[model samples]
Target: MDAGLTPVRVVGAGPVGAVCALALAQQGVPVCVLEAQPETARGDSRTLALAQGSRLILERLGVWSRLADVTPITRIHISQRGALGVTRLDAGDLNVPALGYVLSYAELAAALKQALRDADVAVEYGIAVARIGASAAAAELATADGRTLATPLAVVADGGRGDDAPQPRFERDYDQMAVVCDVQTELPHAGQAFERFTPDGPAALLPKGDRYALVWTAARADAERIAALPDTAFLTALQAHFGGRRGRFLEAGPRKTFPLKLTWTGSEAGNRVVRIGNAAQTLHPVAGQGFNIGLRDAWELAALAGDTPADALGGAAMLAAYARGRRADVVGGLGFTDFLVRTFSNDLGPLRHARGLGLLALEAFPPAKRFVARRMMFGANG
Candidate 1:
């Protein structure tokens, strides 16, 4: 079979899947996207923190300019509550225009959808896959509507939440939940973000348009209590937990909570069937590595596909190569997030002191700080 004549079937039309499809289409690889949700599905209100590297990828795909209300992160302040050590990362020091950008997930999804249409990529909405399997010849998919399809390659980016999703080879329950909402602070953000590590968990505030998007991590029970608090009480609890760094949290939007965990499918999967984004691995949202890693996964896969000969698009060798190339970034991201969650989300006296010293050491060393900052902006390679 001529691989060029067989379009790649991308499952899930979310940001990660859309990126992979757009990149593939731009590389002249025939591609089509299948989204289970209808075109009129409600927009996602979740906010996203995109690193500069992701910005470059979207720019290359010609979708960056289409986004709206994106707020740049000029600086990030990281510290441990009730500790003596603190460290800050400045975009100016790093010589980057901005470390990252914050925007609603819906905005990014809309831009990618529009870009797909402009690139002439075929997208089938409201088509839920009943099963996705792989064979030496091709990747096969069965839809709920009794339709069957086969392609040289199939990309899964549905976040592994579907009934047919693959079971994760590795999983860890953190027993923590994050209370998230948009908050108005007494003081202006001015593009400054905060990562305050507490004994319970890490609390993060990303600068959004004229406000901040808060992800306050705590024990499951505590998070539920916080999320259920009335608006005024919620703001007061937030101020108490996060401190006066941004002054009192004046107002808060609707609060939501999600459990935190680390799940990975490993590098190896079915032949010619690749998983990207949350479909492959979902990590704790401590350092915001999971989503960016997913973007890198999509970008690199598309690049490698473009380089490989059409006849070997999803051959065993190609899959092996893809796995090898992504190992470092994937493992690095997983390890980094896991380490932060375990190491900092505690209150052992000795460990707390050690963490404080570590922060102080990192702050004193310019090169080390830059290295970590770049890794956050890029990946392990950076």
Candidate 2:
């Protein structure tokens, strides 16, 4: 509430929200972040595959160095189930330090929050949003505690929900659950990340130091069964499904499961509000693009706002520009991930043969491998 300070309001304190705040605050803009959670938690078991572009954003925010000790993804391996060929990509191929880094979600969030604190961004914690309304001049946000705050622009980083918001949307439920957990392996992962497409779903193993973080997508019933298995039993099941790609699965840490879905929000320009991050789109995690895409949205919006006048930050003109800039990337990413999930998550004979052949072709062609590598390291949108 300082005089002469340009005001921007952001909801949610997860990665996207935190990164947006950091980006804006770094550019000398005053930002207020409303987070429902009181205190940022640590040791969030969810692991994230940070693309090279995402790393650059974090580095700009002064967060990558603090996360270096916990983030490591030196290589990536992709293959189709029951297929004879596999493609491998190393950071050396791209001549980059590393293709990407895998870090704990909670750790990254905490790091960003700390950076925000150091940058003096005001964060109102433990307050839930009660209602939101926007006008041409400013956005009014009412918290559950009955406090109303107004700002020139309001960015909703909250996860997907279809309500009275002005943004039009498209959504699809995959009827799948991603069962995630950290596991201890007998062999070192050697900083290699695995994306294995099986009949049930796409399972990813991301390197986390001496162990691996597992994201297994499967039917709800199967996910429930897998979640119920004992540590040793789960390891056996995992070994049977994953094979020796990384190494023998020794033991698993805590396990959790959540439904997977694909969502997209239409342009929010005509209306006086803008939705960024997961609120704008929630992608299937099969490609590890969910958080990466969200971060890109946040960074791009922040950059646009920083380059524009205060009065232009969240206005129709600015929001329209943002929507136009983000549309292609968002649609393409959603389509690609959804296609892979549907193509690989079944045993249909024709589609199976086609997808397997596609994988083989990519393995045989160096350029194809490079294209996939580039897309994974730097999103097609980036």
Candidate 3:
């Protein structure tokens, strides 16, 4: 290692990367964060339904308190468009304060960034990692700025196609678009979130202060058409599709749309390098599993890294243990979400009934419901 070298270097400044950096810094580890963009870029384009388990992780890292403008999800109500079954999970039944929370992406990113600054962690902004080269002893990150950062260990949190990709990724276009926006409803959300499965796809309404942040997934062509509708027409159409569960959607803000996809890869940790967050895998948005899983990845990696000897920051044994520890949760999260999207997205009559019955069964079986909630809350182990 070079004299006075940083112990760890993390790429990407998104919530996952920021939280990962904060975890290490909280452990008194010397680390630096590199962001592709300069400063913190705040956005209101999307909202995240953070699981109860994720709040615990963020709280442990001291970033949770920094977040504001979030609304607790007291319950999660699940139902199908034409089905008679309905399943609802209540936080009170589980003796928890909340099942989840609706957080705007900007709120989370800002909180983590602020926590990073307070910890005196160094963050190099506007520097993108163009390439990463690893050896048994050390790792080097080459940047788009024609500069290089050599460190004892490197954690890649940046997500995208790259030269040294970790595993073979499987991707599906899903032929869907997730149209997102915020709206005011005639009926209050009352801290409850709803997941309604339609013939075309799934739509979610999450409590966001006085409004509900709507993530309505639809077939690609339908999404384009819906997105192009005027605000009044769109809200009316949304109410028609979602039914009168929330009475009616009175008004809607501007909307945005993005193609939905299932892009996932395998886990890897070796040669003085590790990957976490979106760099590891990106799952379908159903069930809101991707970010929660990524948060666990960051937390687990930090715990392992915090316990390692400085001399073995990225040594084989340490890297191996990290890889082993994350395998179950990462694989489990990927499998769970993949299975869910495949099963529920189908509109066939038998499959539809099966899915509805599955929800009904989930409600009838307490143990089963608890098990699923725990898994969603705490990942593989829960």
Question: Clashes in each model (backbone N, CA, C under 3 Å)?
Answer: 0, 0, 0
Ranking by lDDT: 1, 3, 2
Select the stronger candidate by TM-score from 1 and 3. Answer: 1
Instruction: Tell me the whole-model lDDT of each prediction, alpha carbons only.
Output: 0.90, 0.82, 0.84
TM-score of candidate 3 to 2 decimals:
0.95
Order of quality (TM-score)? 1, 3, 2
Alpha-carbon lDDT of model 3: 0.84
RMSD of each: 1.5, 1.9, 1.9
In order of appearance, the predictions have TM-scores of: 0.98, 0.95, 0.95
Q: Write the per-residue lDDT of candidate 1 for residues 12-96, one digit (tens) a residue.
A: 9999999999999988888888999997775578889999999999999999999888999999999999988999999999999
Point out the higher-scoring one by lDDT: 2 or 3.
Answer: 3
The numbered model that scores best in lDDT is: 1
* Model 3 ranges with Cα > 4 A deviation: 1-3, 161-167
- In model 2, which runs have C-alpha deviations exceeding 4 angstroms? 161-168
Tens digits of lDDT, candidate 2, 194-251: 8999998999998887778899998887898999899989999999998886668888
Those runs of model 1 whose alpha carbons end farther than 4 Å from true positions after fitting are 1-4, 267-270
Summing lDDT over every window of 10 consecutive residues in candidate 1, give the lowest-scoring window: 1-10
